[model samples]
Target chain A: MDMGKGVGLVETKYITVASHPHELTLESGQHFGPVEVAYETYGELNQRGDNCIIVPHALTGEAHVAGRHTPEDRVAGWWDELIGPGRALDTNKYFVVAANVIGGCCGTTGPKSTNPETGKPYGADFPLITIRDMVQVQYLLLKNLGIRRIKAVIGGSMGGMQVLEWALMYPEMVEAIVPIAASGRLAAQCIAFNAVQREAITGDSDFKGGHYYPGPGPIRGMGLARQIATITYKSDESWASKFGRTFSSIRPQDYYSLDNRFEVEHYLDYQGEKLVQRFDANTYLYLTKAMDLHDLGRGRGEYREVFSRFRGKVLSIGVSSDFLYPKYYQEEIHHFFKQAGADSHYWELISPYGHDAFLIEFKKMSLKIAQFMQTLS
Target chain B: MDMGKGVGLVETKYITVASHPHELTLESGQHFGPVEVAYETYGELNQRGDNCIIVPHALTGEAHVAGRHTPEDRVAGWWDELIGPGRALDTNKYFVVAANVIGGCCGTTGPKSTNPETGKPYGADFPLITIRDMVQVQYLLLKNLGIRRIKAVIGGSMGGMQVLEWALMYPEMVEAIVPIAASGRLAAQCIAFNAVQREAITGDSDFKGGHYYPGPGPIRGMGLARQIATITYKSDESWASKFGRTFSSIRPQDYYSLDNRFEVEHYLDYQGEKLVQRFDANTYLYLTKAMDLHDLGRGRGEYREVFSRFRGKVLSIGVSSDFLYPKYYQEEIHHFFKQAGADSHYWELISPYGHDAFLIEFKKMSLKIAQFMQTLS
Candidate 1:
């Protein structure tokens, strides 16, 4: 098992994958060739290989989900709090694995990843992927690791989408699933936010239709997109308290001109510029499109019939202030499970951090999740 | 008496210089040239010419404040609500006059106006203007119209800024003032919002640095800027009740595929595109920047000292829900007036419409305004 990035003091064997040839046959009867999957593992697989936990990441998250295993990279793992020694998932007892989604900027075979055939970045040449495709790739990764069943499929946000897919696609292969701060499908507001972000990128002259890498890549446009995203990620109440009527420099140098002043404006600029450095514009576009297409049980027939595919226990968590994947979405999930006759539990966690509550309020949330998982025994 | 746009149908007299020379030396010590001003007359000026009431316009508002008497190009006025008839400013009793400012696109010499020197659109060649420069041009326009002492100065938003400037610049010529939904000085947050909007326009590749006319002129970027402005125009509670998680698009067009689904996405796109048709991107930038530089007290010393210049009766009205120019801004005016020993009345009107209440809640606000003006008797 491999320890994750950002966490220190852990010992584990890391599962490695060779550059194996990958082929994906899509719903359109089309086939994609020369695919590669990049993933990292933590903790250890038990004798039955049934103690494994899987985490799917959000739009920008990489495969590094738990500890700071890479000494050179100093950033903390995305889920450092929930998966560690004696923590929520308790890496001491259960194995954990997280993969960079197939179409991501990370090491996964995404837009940023090189096309083996062309010897250049896939860019827009990569076909648009659905959530089902991502889940299928993760399943292949698990098979490569010799794991037949997952003790629990767990994730939040986009990660949570994968958790739902795992439960439905291979019911007996997953005993329990925890989908946190996620929705069964992308609502109108979510799609709207993503559209604005995409416009910010596509409208930029530097974008070049997602092929402007090696040169400048619409950083300002991408920043504006991030600015829009930043607004939805947090609550309005947060902005009121943080900015209000604060003033700023009017023309940069004038001290007393009373010009170009407002704290919210500065905050937005900072948010836009910061995302430009850490994220790629094309990746943002593709991942958001993936999120917009995510619907757990849409194809199997009615929502009830689709949810009935999963016969295992399920735990769904939502944050009170998460307007993105709101509590109402979680309520819908609970209703679907109940109607499907699955033993499902739904919990709401109160936090003022908005959609980011899953990460910030992880202490209380982690305890609840740990307790729920222990009940699976 | 002149008929303001929406005011009572009165036959007003006006003359267009058609070739009026504009341009003034800015406080920045730069010479700006080739200017124009559009004006209309209400009741004839008395022999002493002291009954004149100078009415300034707000953001995006033209100086057609009353009805038009000319049969050639008849256009209704913008302020038909508060002028003419037995309304707040009875035209029969007072000599009312209004003029389009120097930097406005409405009939005045602005960026869109042909530069007499070059006979081409001024575009960005127009010198950057200060609020003081705008007031000075209005002063020049009034001088050319053979006006001396004025009875009063009134306006809201940008117009409010002019009213405050008139009081400070030519206190003795003003007898009374009404400033609605205005601020003492532009705050930091206000400036920041304006800055971001300007950035959005100039950052667009199609903007051509304000020269993209006869073409689209970065309409998409302008639309995005307006969307941002629209968000600030209304209160948080209003948006919450109006939008919530409701689908933004009533008809799903499948514009981008299943990945780009949502009503809010479509709503914002429609709104952003709609604004580009009605608004000029450069004009928007210039006007917002003017508002950013509007501070009657800036560099002129203390705010109280600036208020001391207004030796007249003052009435300041603010809307309770107006976050743009909050009620506290009204209180600031009231405080400054009290310190200056000027007779002043301040009223806060409770309304849910926010900054827009000044325009919508006329019934309640007009009563307070009329009563205050009567007290000046």
Candidate 2:
């Protein structure tokens, strides 16, 4: 099963996997069976098969993290700048892989996918999964591809959570890991944000629990949640700079009625609407819960003990303005890595984008991740 | 018409006329009938009548801005600090007066007030009023008291707006004016906040467009609006300082379902519930609209020209952390006052309470106003 392809625009037949059933037992004791993992690949696998990178995404992100080679898929990838030729990760140099995480809306087995038991969408019956469970499924995906190990794993925020999980769960398999804008455990504030987001969805009259799938399950509530979350993701300074008290020049004939004509309000509406269109509501609930439950040292006791499990070199990055998971959190992980005697490096990316800094300030973040990987080489 | 008593608190009376109406013709080619103003008084008026101090209430404040003697009405006034004996605007020293604006819930002519024509609450039928109109009513109240002139007029936020109007509309009547945490005109952001608040109420299904008096007009929506407004009233710094992220020690074991357990969540719920209890939804709409339309120079043209009309001594105080109406707004007014060659002074109060700083830091503000008034004397 040497399902590997050479470096190019990633239009190769690398994504086709023989139809197979992969079971994922969740944290809630219920089992999710026959999962399909959709992935894409770039760059050549070396003869030794060592130069490989697994790019895990945050919630609602698709496997289309790069490229626009195919005419049908001409749309640019979510991370085109960081993953393309001569830039950061440099697809011309290293084999980069990105897979839609299990229990995702993006081509992966999720609530939206058909359940074999009943020919309908899994809907609310989908078993709740933890970050570790998602990682285990990813591990299985890699195993099926005849890939024994990864040279490095790079991701930020929830992506970073996956990287941490990968490093700890498969110590020998991961040579290096970069976790950006991530924390060892979700803070109470982070959990609170999630709780509110969940409540917004559940609070809506249209939302009959998770059963309002055939119709709309609290789209407005979900939009409101995203609007609130968007506020937290960006810095206050950014909002002040861009939209500070300025209304759009465009005016409706009846301006007396309550309507959002401000640039910031429009911006929030766009963000909220786009999110609602692309993201499944149930997946948001499940993934947020995963992030909340994620503490590398949960059963392992202390952080040192958790770090001790990871034999891989750690390269962690934090954003200066990311109040959600501040720089202190990355520093704590760095200290643990150092104490655990791992070849660890820590860096802080000074960006005003806050928690979304990794996504927005890609040029700076890419250089740092590339440099760290080059050092590993 | 000379309604005067000796200069003492005992001589002052808490005048409560539930729906005192007076008909008036508007400059907008509109004739509105029987508008009511709820009001209260403190201290005694001298025969010479040069000791009156009109204390305007802030947004959402009623005529009960000072102490209520009766046990049933014993709730301390919003600004009790400035009204007591030997205090800043000492009741023993000055005759104090406060009034519920035309479009208010408490004993004033508002949406909730009965329409003399139909015996139903005015509700949405209450014609729109400008801050100038509010000032006009206050002027009548003053004349009705047989007070030819006020020694000083002091107020904060919306009250400050009224104070500015008083100085402009009746320059000779006002000897000195203290406008705190306010601007000549509501800023774009301020208007935007008000718009959101109005939307929260109107967006609710239960809101029958101010005609919900038959039942109730969306208590949940009103609550949500209050929650949002409360956030703006205080700075994020204040919330972090007061209740960062703390859950009660003993969880309400019975509340295992949805309703929040976190202190911050509870705090928000309490604030929302408290506001809905006292406030009329329709009144909230009308008053906020008036606040939005409150530009002192809207029809009067340029800033300086409108401000030049004020010959009274102005003592303007702005809060450092009030993002709602920032210090820059006060500076704008101060610049106009300076440019107009008006007798004016501006003070910036440094407080972490933000817009609500005026109410919470009343003692400090009272001292500043008292000292300024004494200088005029």
Candidate 3:
């Protein structure tokens, strides 16, 4: 019942797939076996088993999607605000499911996962996986759960990438898809930022080429990576409004000291430290690289051809201030869906929170998702 | 004269200031002595010595403002296109001087410079300096050159910060000021990027608390910092146009390989390696810290009050794509100059190069600078 720090919802469960001869061959031609997926479910599956809704999570997100198991639990699931009985996800009406993707650290098969072959932690030996691979793993999990067609699959950012993949790979399985703050292909700037973060992790002497686990690990590198990522996650307007040029109250009034003088610096340092405490450095590397390799059209012929196969209604949402996955990306997806003559709707969330708006401005997102859900009915 | 890689024009000169017993007191109340400044001059000082134009270099810029001493010199001075004969700066008509800043590595007294007291490098012991301190050093150099007043002072980015400082700290001495692609105060996002870069350098175990000079210093960390910074110096539009999601031609066609996939990654890696080769990591820390402390109205009452003291024609130019020092920042400077009722003009350079447009896209900047010079006359 304690659930521990970063442990997902109290009801979170695990399913192991691709064990032994059923090894999952990745897009890179490498295979991983006995992959474990941590997930949580809410509400009822219903008689028809068609009311299930899968929710994929963004980078650093866990399997927990709603509710706290223990009374002393300080944090609820990430989507606790929107996945309750009367919320947008409306657990009373829909059976909601959220799963930690492969390459994630939170009880999911990742760099920290043990390799059955070597009887050692995979570490750097974890085969590179893609958004498609993650979606395939989720599909296998859903199949093993005895679910065929899902009512909807909703996600944002990297989760959105998974949503896109789900619609493309298993078009007949999902009735609706909501991909928010995501792109068919990540922009060059986004890739650049991710590349730098990977460099920060690898450059650390503590990283030891991603084999630094079972020890203190590359905390400094991971912390620095988190700091860089936190900057891209928030908009300039958001930072200006929240911190501005205000100096930290605790710091001395030394004019040109190297110590954190600005409140923003202090905030970033805190964010970095927070991530280092909870996140694994090797997992960070693997997952970010997976995000960077997310190109839907890769190995696929034309994007229009790919979208044309999807029978589900598409609801694409973007944040106006989101630079990481800009509004244009969502628009592009909408355009492709429209080109295919598929039922599609595009909505832009105007917020100063940047790429993080989907998580922060829940009211607007909740309204949109609820409206989209009605169309699915 | 082979001036060496990254060295300024052959005509560059040096002058030692703040020698022993006359140590320069920095904004942080720390003192440093035997400070040497490297500078280069174009054209002659007129009989009245009033044809001088002191140009302050940016964060990584050197004293090279124009021309090459030898025809075989592969790289000309940074602003060579704008500061030559009949050019924007018009070396034929006006004397132009560009000096390396106090905390700069290029022939200036910086962290790499030896401490007279310790007889070793200053390294981390180098006193924290501000933009005002840099301007003061240039002021001393000008005084040593027997120049009472200059025709104008011109700079962009960090150089622009120095231009504002020079006008405010010595109003009567500068006749005109041209600050391009700069801000009165660094925005929170800028500070955040700088903080990450500093963390990267300091986090390097090889950094050795900033005393990693005269040996293999924090090259990897410095490289990573430069990689992060290179992204900021460019616009998303530019990166898309130049590199896009194009894969590196040399890399294998493996779908999910960890190697540099995109051309942008290769470009960033090249930029990082280039900086690590020539630059001192400790100097990078000092100079970036100086930039972060740049506040025109730090000790001064208000922004308007600070601008009112500058009796000079102000021409503020901004790159339309510059995110680091956005056009909005330049507009703010122009606003304050106009509020003070000082002669001011604002121009925006339409370019995809972003913050680096001042260095690239020379033709447009050249014409603007030429027209502004005519107005000054």
| Tens digit per residue, CA lDDT, model 2, B83-202 | 766677777777888888877788767788778888998777777776777787777777777788698888888898998888888887788888888888766556656655665677
When only the first chain is scored, the TM-scores of the models are: 0.90, 0.91, 0.95
Q: How many times do residue backbones clash in model 2?
A: 2
Give the 10-residue window scoring lowest on summed lDDT in candidate 1 chain B.
B1-10
iRMS (Å) per candidate: 5.2, 5.0, 1.3
Q: Is the docking of candidate 3 incorrect, acceptable, medium or high quality?
A: medium
**What TM value does model 2 have?**
0.75
Better of 1 and 2 by TM-score: 2
Superior candidate under TM-score, 1 versus 3: 3
Name the runs in model 3 displaced over 4 angstroms: A1-10, A249-253, B1-10, B249-253
**Tens digit per residue, CA lDDT, model 3, A207-239:** 898787688888888888999999988887888
- Using DockQ as the measure, what is the rank order of every candidate, best first? 3, 1, 2
Question: For model 2, how big is the CA root-mean-square deviation?
Answer: 6.9
For A190-275, candidate 2 gives per-residue lDDT tens digits of 66556556655655567676777678676876776676577667664566566755656465432233232556667776887889
Q: Score the docking of each candidate (DockQ).
A: 0.16, 0.14, 0.68
Please identify model 2 stretches exceeding 4 Å from their true place.
Answer: A1-61, A69-75, A94-104, A109-200, A229-272, A284-377, B1-31, B45-59, B72-75, B81-83, B115-119, B122-140, B146-197, B233-261, B287-376
